[model samples]
Target chain A: MSTIDPTGHPNVHQTAAELATGDKTDTLLQTDGLRKDFGGFTATDEVDFSVDAGELRCLIGPNGAGKSTLLKLVIGTYAPSAGSIYYNGRDITDLAPHRRVRRGISMKFQVPSVYGELTVRENARLPIQRFADGEERRRRVDDAIAAAGLTGYEDVAASVLSHGQQQQLEIGMAAALEPDLLLLDEPVAGLDVAEREAIAERIVRLNEEEDIAFVVIEHDTDFVASIADEVTVLHNGDVFREGPVEEIKADPDVQRIYLGDEQ
Target chain B: MVANTTDGAGSADAGGPMDALRRRIEGPNTVGNSRGFWIGFTVAVASLVAYPLAVGSYQASRFSLFLVYAFLGLSLSVVWGYAGVLSFGQVVFFGIAGYTFGIVSVNFATPLGITAAFLLGVMGSALVAAVLGYFMFYGGVRDVYVTIITLVSTLVLHTFMAQTAGDEWTIGTAALGGFNGMPTIPTLALGVGGAAFTFDSVTFYYFVLALLIATYLGLRAVVNSDYGRVMVAVREDEDRTRMFGYDVKRTKLAVFTLGGALAGLSGVLYASWGNYVSPQVFELAFASLPVIWVSVGGRKTLLGAVVATVGIEFVRNSLGGEWAFIAVGSLLLVFVLGLPGGIVPWIHRAYVDARGDATASNPPEAETVEVSD
Candidate 1:
C-alpha cells in the first residue's frame, strides 16, 4: 500500500486500506459517507473521497453538482447531516472551521474576502497574525505577499486591487497560514488569461516545491486538467466518476454530465 | 519567512535630521507600528502633565468632564471598533455607576469609606454590563439585534431608576436624586504621608488625567497584542477569524467587559466632578452622544476619540445654548461627510505629505514592499 504511487491516478484499494488503518502519509484528508441536507433537499449525498499528501485534486461537475457543498463539509464550515471527515488520521467531523485551519487546513473563498478598507499587506497580515505569531507571523506575511506577486502594492488598498489581484491576495492569505491542505473554490473564476496562468503556475509550483495538498473546485475543465493529478466528478450530490484527468475526461458518464449527449 | 532588516532604516534615511523628525511627527504608517505606539504614549503623557496647569478652575472642571467623556468614547471604540458590536446602551452603565455611588455614599458610607462606595458603584455597573454582554455576545444576538437589545436595556434601566427615586421603599427623592440629581458628593480623598488630601478641580483634573492615560496605555497594549489582533480580525471578517481558531464569542465578551469597566470608571469620575447622580444621565440622548463622539473622532484611533471628545466639548462651551448645539452638530456633520477619516487621519496625512520624501507621501507603499516575500 505504501509503495503504491498516487502520482498519476488514485489506487482505490491502497487508499481505502490506508484510510482504515489510519495511515498518515498518503492521505492528508479523507471523507467517509459524508452527507449534507438543506431542508428536504440533499446537497451532498453519502460520498467517499481522499486526497494524498502533496497531490493537487480537482472537484468538477456542472452547476448544482455539490462541489461547493462538499468543500464546505470537508472544512467543517457545514456540518455533515451524517458521516465523518478525517484530517491526517484524526477524526475532525465536529471541529470548527478555525480549529480545522489551526490543524493545518485553510480555504480561500470563491469571492475575495480581503478587507476592502485595509491595504493589501494589512489584509494578508490579518490571517498571518491569526495563524502564526512572533517572528514567524511577519515572515509568513512577507512570503505570501511575494508569492502573490504583490510586492510593490502592499500599501494599495485591497479595494484598489484588480479582480485578479484580489483573488491572488485571497490565495496569499490562505498560503500565509502554511496549511497542509489548501482548499481553493473557483480560484480563477474572474481572471483574465494572464492572471489565470499566473495563479495556475503558482498553484503548480506550491504543490511541487512545498508538497502542499490541494482540493480545488473549478468549472474550467482545462485548468483542472492542467493541474489536477486526480479529478473527481460530482453529479446530483454524488460522485459520478473519479479517476485520472485523461480517463475521467474520456469517461462516457462524465462526458454525459459535463459535456452533454452530443459528446 | 524573510527576516525584517528594516530596523536601521529609520536612522539610515539620512536625507537629514529633519527627515527623521518628519517621520516621527508623521506617526507610523501601519496600525501596528511601534513608532505610533511611542508617539501616542508621549502625547498622552504630555496631555496628562500639561492640561491641569494650563486651565483655570472653571476650565479645569470642564476638562475633567471632557476626560470622563473621553473615557466613555474609548469604551464605545472598543466595543464598536474592535469587536464590531454597536452598543447603544453604554450610558446605562455610566448612569448605574453614578447612582450606585450616590446611593451608597448617602446611605452606606459611615461604615464603608467614600472610596469603598465609589469602587462598589463602578463594580456594580461592570457586573450589570457583563451580564448583559454575555447574553448579547454569546446568545447569538448580532449587529442590529445587539444594538436594539442594548438600547432597550437602557430604556428599561432609565425607567427603573426613575421609579426607584419615586418609591417609598427606595432611598427615594433627593437621596438617589430623581430629575434634579444628587449634590454635595464627597471629594476623592488621597493621602500622602499622614495627611489626607481632598481633590479640588485642579487635583481632580490630574487624577482623571492619570486614569485616562492608564486606560489609554492599557487599551493600546490590548489592541496591539495577539488578542487585540484577533479582536480586529473579528471586526474585519468574523467567519475568517473564527476559522483561524478564535472563539469569536469569547473575544467579543472580553472586549465588552473591558469596555464596560472603562465606562464605569468614567461614571465614577463624572459623579465625583458633578457631585450628582440622576436618571437624566441614563437618557437616550446621553446614550447616543458617545456614539457620535466615536464616529466624529475616528473609530479606530483611541487618541482620535479623546481629541474629538475634547474638541466637541470646547466648541459646545464656547458657543453655549442653541448655537453651541448647532456648531457642534455642524462640525459633526462635516466630520461625518467631509472628513470621514476623522481629525487624526487628516493630521497624520498632512504631516506625512509635508515631509516631501518619495516614501513619505506613500508610506503604505513602503509597508507593501516590506510585506512582499
Candidate 2:
C-alpha cells in the first residue's frame, strides 16, 4: 500500500516511510501542547502524545475522560483551540478531516455508522471505491467483509445485522480505507467475548502484517491488555499515565484512576 | 470445457442481448428493479405518447405545461431525496431562470438571442446555487436549518420581485411586471437567421415530453452510477461518508447546483410555454407545491416525482378552485401518514414481496449469533 507522507509542506527530501524505516523507532504521530476547550470546559488540555509506526496502542480512561476527544482532534473532527499536531515529523494541525484521511489518518466513531439501507458489500465498497475499482476494489471489499467476519451476510442490509455485526461492519468500512494510522473509538465496545477475541486478533494481524498504526480508545482493560504494545491512560483531559501494557496494568495510580474504576 | 462446466445450470439468457440492459436499470441506488416495474414503465411511456396524439394541439400544449413542472419535482427529488438537503428554493432557481430567459429573449429578439437566453438562464441558476450552496454547506449550516434558510430565501425573492412592478424595474427591453408578470415574451427558438427553427405549440409540447424523458432516464443513469452511490452514502451518514476521504460539502454543493440547473430548465420552458414569467412562480402557495409533489410521490424515485407532478398538476388545472389545494393537501397528509416511503417504493415493496426476491426482508438462516450491546 502507498502512504501519503503528510507534512503539510510537500516536496520534503524524505518520505514518511523512509523516516520510519531509517530509525525504526521514529514517531508516526505526535501532538504538542494540544488543548481543546468546549466553552467553559476543556476536553483535552496541554497534552503531549505520540504513536510509533506499526505500533498498536490502547487508550484507556474512565467515563468522561478525553480519549475520544483526543482521537477526534487527531482525525481533524475537532479543531484544537491551542497547540499543534505533527504527522510524519511535520505540522498538520490545520488539515481538514478528508485531507487528513487522504494523508492516511482516519477513525471510526463510537456509535455504529454503517449505512442501514445498504448491504454489507456496498458499505465496504464505499471507501474502497474511491481508491480502487473493478477487481482490486472487489478484492479489498471481500477482504474487509471477511475480516469483519461478515462473509455470509454480504447481501443483507446492515440495519438487520446484530449490533455487534453493525459495529464490525463499521470497522470493515474504516479498514477498507487502508490508512497509515487508524483510530478506532471503542471498536469492540458492544461485541460479545467471541466476537471481541476475533476482532482483537484481526486488529493485531493488521498491525503486524499490514503495518497500520492504531490508537484504539477502549474501555475493556482485559481487551486492552490482550492487544496493546503500549498503553496511555487519560483522566479528566490529561495523560495520567503512559507505558508498556504490563507497566500500565501494574501502576497503582493508573489502577485508582482507571482500572480500579471498572464497574 | 469452462463453457461446458456450468452448461447444465438452470439459467438461460433472455435473448442474450437484453442481459446487459437488465443490469443498468436495476442498480442498488433505486427502489424499483423488478421486471414488472420495467413493463409498467414502457406502458406508461407508450400511453403518454398516445395521449397527445388523441388530443387537439391546444389540449396537448396545455398538457405540456404539466410536463414542464415535472423538472421541478425531479429537482427537489435530487436535493432532498438523495442528497438529504431539504430545500424550498427549487422554485427560487426556477423563477430566476424564467425571468432571466424572459429578459434576455426580449432584449435580443432573435433566434440566436433565444438560444443565448437558454444557456444564460440555466447557467445563471447553477451559479446562484453554487454561491448559496457554498455558504450553506461550507459555512456549517446543515439539516433542517438548510430547509429554513432556503424557505426564507424563496419568500425573500418573492417579496422582492413583487415590489419590482415600478418603471425603474425594467431590465433592458423587459419589464419586471411584478405581480402582473411579463407577458408576450417570445417562446423558445433555435439556430441562426433564415435557418431558424421555432418550437410551435405542437412541437414545443413534443419537445418538452422528449426532454422530460431524456432527463428522467439520464438522471436514472446518474443515480445508478458510482457518484450517485456516494450521494446516497452521504445521505445515509454525512460524518461517516466524510471520514472516508470525501469532501462532503462539495458533494452536497454539486448536487444542489445540479438541482438548481434542472429547475432552471423547467423555468425556461415554463416562461416560453406560457409566453409569460411571473412572481407567482415564487409565491408561497405555489412554491410549496414541489414539496407536496415530491413528498406525495416518492422523492427517492425520479419517476415518482415526474408522475406525481404531472398527475397532481393535471388534477389541479381541471379543478381550478380551492378544492384543488384541499385535495392535494389531503393526499399529502394521507401519504405522509400511511405510506411514508411514498408511492413508488410502497408499490415496489409489494412487488418485491410478491416476487420473493432474496434482496429483501427475510430471516437469516440458522447459525444464530447472539446480539450484544
Candidate 3:
C-alpha cells in the first residue's frame, strides 16, 4: 500500500508501512538556491533552507516576505524558476505535488482546510485511505483523529467545529498520512489566544510523539517562541535570519520588521 | 452529510455479495438511506414498473425518452453535484454516442451490429472525455475555464456537424445528415440472428428502468467506497487533495470519462428509441438542459437527478412551448436560490427532521447537523 517511494522518487511504489524512520541528524527536507518568479515578480528568490528529521521549525515573515511562497515551493505548489528542492536525501524539485505527498510530505493550507461539508471521520479517512486499505485504514483514521484530540468528535460535521477545532481537524487530516514532514501555512491565524495555545500544544505534541518534522509558516512571534525549537525569518524573498528559536526571537532586524511591528 | 460513512461496523463483516451490495445501496455517503428512503425507493421503482399499466402506449414511449435523459442527469449530478465539477454541456457526449450508434447500427442493421454500436458509442464518448480531460486538467485549465472549454467543445461540434450536408459527408450507408439528421436507424437488440431479442416500447422502458436501478445502486456504492472518498476530496478542494497524495488530475479525468460513458449510454438509448440522430442534439439548448435537470433535482443526490429529469421533462412536455420554459426557468430559480441542495435533498431534510436525526438515535457521540449548506 505504499503510494510513494522516497528512495527512488517519481512515484515508485513499494510497501512502505515499515519504512525506516531516519535518525534525527538526517536532513528531511532542504532547498538549495530555490527561486520562484511569478511572471516578472519573484516571490522567493534563491533562498537556501533545511530542516532536520523530527525538528519543529517555524518560519516568520512580514507581508510579501515569501514565507507562504517558500512553503508552496517546498510542497511543489509552485515550481521554482531556478534552483531545486531536495527531500529525504533525494532531488525532488521536478516531482509533481502528489508525488511529493507520496514521498511523505504533507501540507495544511492557510485557509479553513477542512472539507467543511464532510464529517470529521470522512475528512480524516481521505488521507489515510489513500495509502492504507481496509482495517488498517480504519485503524489509522481513528488513531489520527484521536491524536488530533478529536476522538469523540468523529461523527460531527467539520464545519460546525470551532475555528480552532477546524484547524485541528485539518492538521489531523494532514497527519493521517503519517507523513514524515508536514508544512503548515498560518495554522493559528484565525484563532483566539486560548485557541492558539491549544493548537500550539497539539503541534508540539505531534512533533515529539510521531517524530514528524514540521515547518510552520506563521507571523506570530510569541506562538513561535513557545513551540518552535528553531526558527527561520524571511524578508523580501530571502532568508533574513535563521537560528535557535530564542536567539532568532532576539534578533534586532526580525523584531524591528516583524515582531516589533506586531507589538 | 457524508457523515455516517465512517461507521463501517454497521455493515456486519460476514455478509454475502448481495448483502454487501445492499449495504452500498443503503450507505451513508449519499443523501438518502433512511429506512423511509428505501421504502420510498421500492415504492417508486414499483410504480415506474407499473407506470405503463396506467398510461397509454404513447405516453409510455414518451416517458422512456425521459428515462434516457435521466442517464444524462445522473452523469451531471456525479460530475457536477457530487464531484463539484459543474459541466454546462453534458449533452455533447449524448450527441457523440447517438451519432456513433446511429452510424454503426444503420450500416449493419443487425443484433450484433447494435451490440457493437453500443460498446463503440460508450467507449467513443469516454475516449473523447479522457482526451479533453487530459488537456484541461494537466494543462492547468481550472474551475470556470473547464466549464467554458466543455461548452466550447459542444459549440464546435454543433457548428461542424451542422455544415456536413453534402454527399461527401456520408459514412458508408449512413449519411452525416447535417441539420436534416439520420433516420431509419435500427432499434437496439442483443444476441445473434435467430436468437436476437429486440425491444419494443414497453420492453425498452422496462429494460432501461432496470438498467437505471442497477446503475444508481452501483454508483451509490462506488461513491461510498474508498475511491469515492477521494472523488469527494478532489471536489471539495483540489490543492488540498493534491497535498494529501492524490493525483487529482487523474481522478478528475476518470470521473469525467465515467460521466461521458453515462451520457453516452443515454445517447445510445435515444438513437435506438427514435431511430434518428441530429446535430440539433448538440445545440446549446440540449447541451444546457442536463445542468438544469440535475440542478433542480438536487445536484448532490442521484435520486434527485433521476426524479428531476423525468418529472421536469414530463412537466415541460405537458406545459408545452413558452409556458414550459417559464415553468422550468422558474423551478431552476427556486431551487438554485431557495433550495440549493435541490428538491430531493430538501425533502430528505424534512423527512430526517420529522424522524429526528438518525445519529440522535445512536448511542455514542451523537451529533446532529442541520445541513443547510
Candidate 4:
C-alpha cells in the first residue's frame, strides 16, 4: 500500500487514464468546459462530459436547456466559444462536422436527414459510398441495412417510410459509417411505445454487440431511463445534475425541474 | 419520435394497391448491371463516331464545331454541375488560349509546331485558370461573390485585350487582327508515310473528332475517380465535404483549373478551324453560352453535354443565319422551362418507365438481419 502512489489510486486513475485516451481508448469521447455563445446570448455554458467505450449515455433536458445546441457543438456543427473536445486522444475542438464523422463519429439528426427524392437504400448508400470504398464499404452498408430492421424496405423512397421506419433508416445511414461513437438526437422523440422500445432496444443491442459509444439526447425520461447507463441533465444551458439513472431520478432538483417546486 | 406515431397508424391500415405497387416498385433487380450501361455507351459512341461520315463534309465541318462546344460545355459541367460553382467567364480561357495559339503562330513564328503551340496554349490557360481559381475559390466567395468576381474578371480581360490589340511593343493589334480576327491560321499537319497532309475540312473533322473522343474518355475517367466523387460530394454538401478531411477550396480550384484547360483546348480547336482569334471570343455573350449548353444538356452526364451541344448546333445550322438564333433561342426556352432535367435524363426516365420494371423506380431491399433490438 505504501509502495503504491497515493496520487494514482488504481481504480480512479485507471478510469481517468482510460478517459484521457479519448476516442481511441475505452473512452469514445471527452468534452472539457465546452461553451457556445451567440452574440450576447450564451447557448451552451461550459460543459464537461465523457462517454465510455460502448456505453450508452442519455442527455435529458426540458425545452431551452440547450441539449441540441450542446450536440451541435459536440459535432462541430457549431464552434464552441471556449474549452476543448478530444476524440481518439486528438484535439478535435475545431474540426469540421464531416471530419468528425470521418474520424469515426456519426450522428442522427432530431429530424431525419433522408433525401425525399432518393429511395431509402440510395439515400443510405450515397453517404456510404461517399465515405467508404472497396469491400469494407459494401459490407458495412449491407450490415447497416440489416441492423436498421429495413430488410425488405430498402427500395422504398425515404419519403414513403413510416415515421418509426424513417428514424431507423436514419440510424442505419449513420451506422453505415462504422463509427465508434453514435450520437442520437431524440431518436425516439416522436415514436409510439412500440417504436420507442424498438429503437431503445436497438440502441442497447448496438452498444453491446458493436461496442459503439452512444450519446443520446432525449426529453423523454422513460426513454432515457430505459437505455442510459449514465444520465446528464441539462438546465438553462448548464448541467443541472449527472449520475446513474436511479440517482438522477431520485434527485430533488431534477424532480423540481420536471414537476415544479410547488408540486 | 412518439408524438407523431399515432397519426401514421390510420394511413398504414389504408395501404392497398399503392402499397403493393410500392413494394413491387421497390424490389431488387434480377438482371445484371454492367450489360445495360455498356450497351448504351456503345450505341452513343457509335452514333458520335459515325455521324460525320454519314452526313458528309459540310455537316461534318459543322459537327467539328459542335465537338469544340461539347468540350467547352463539359469544362463548365465540372465547375457548375459537379462543384456547384457558376462561372460566366469560362469563355475568357477559350479566348485567351485561342489568342495564345494565334499570336504564337502568326506574329511570333509561323513554323512553330502545332503540337508545341497547342501544348503552350493548354498549359498557359490552365495556369491562368488555376491562379484565378485560387483567388476566387479560396477567397470564401459564394453565389453572388462568385458571379460578380468572374464577370468582372472577364470584362476586365476583354477590355484589356481590346485596348492592347495594337501596341508598338506588343505583337501589334494587327497581329491579333483586332475585331475581324486572324484569318488563314494554319491547320494541323499530319505526317503520313513520307509526306504530310494539310488538315483540310474532312481531315480537320477527324482531328477534332479524335480530340473530342480523347476529351470524353479523359473526362469520364476523371469524373469516375475518387476526385470526381469528392467534387460531387462537395456539390451535395460543402460543409459536410469540408468536415470530411477535404479542403473544399483546393478541390474547387482543381476542378476549376481542369475545366479551364478543357475550355482552352476547345478554344485552340475553334481557332484552328475558323482561322481566327478575336476579342469577341472573350465577350460576355459568348461567355454565357456554354452555361446554357450545360443546362440544356444533362449536367452530370458527359454524354448528355456532348449530345446537347451537337443537337443545339444542328438546330442552329439547319435554321440558317438570324432565324437560327430565334429558333434556337425559342427551343432553348422550351428546354429550360419544360425539361429542366435536360433531354438525356428525361429520355432515360421515359425509357425506364416504359420498360415497366417496378424496381427501376427504387433500390434493392436489404438482404440480411443483423440487429433487431
Clashes of each: 3, 1, 0, 14
Q: What is candidate 3's lDDT per residue for B138-222, written digit by digit as tens? A: 8998889989989999999999999888899999999987888889988889778899889879888888999999998888888
Q: Which pairs clash inside model 2?
A: A190-B373
- List DockQ, one per candidate, in order: 0.27, 0.49, 0.43, 0.18
Arrange candidates by DockQ, descending: 2, 3, 1, 4
RMSD of each: 6.9, 4.5, 5.0, 9.6
Top model by DockQ, which number? 2
Off-target runs (Cα >4 Å) in candidate 1 are: A1-26, A130-138, A259-263, B1-55, B107-112, B166-184, B190-196, B317-334, B354-373
Task: Give lDDT tens digits, candidate 2, residues B283-344.
Answer: 88888899999998888888789989999999999998999999998998998899887897
Comparing 1 with 3 on DockQ, the higher-scoring candidate is: 3
As a whole number from 0 to 100, the lDDT of residue B1 in candidate 4 is: 12
lDDT of 2: 0.84
- Error in Å for residue A225 of model 4: 1.9
Those runs of model 2 whose alpha carbons end farther than 4 Å from true positions after fitting are A1-10, A13-25, A259-263, B1-22, B366-373
**Which regions in candidate 4 have their CA more than 4 angstroms from the true location?**
A1-28, A96-98, A115-137, A152-166, A189-193, A246-263, B1-56, B107-112, B143-148, B168-185, B189-198, B221-230, B240-250, B317-332, B362-373
Tens-digit lDDT track for model 4 on B84-113? 788887887888888887766554333345
lDDT of each: 0.75, 0.84, 0.83, 0.71
Docking quality class, candidate 1: acceptable
DockQ-based CAPRI category assigned to the predicted complex of candidate 2: medium
Q: Which candidate is the best by TM-score?
A: 2
Residues B1-373 of candidate 1 have per-residue lDDT tens digits of 1122121113325577845543443212223233544566688678667765776677777877888788899998888877788899888888888777776666644423567767887798788888998987768798999899989988887787676544463563236545666776666654433465566788888888888877776776677555666777788788766655678888888888878877888887788788777777778867877877888887777777787887787777777787876776777788889988777767755644554433334534232211211
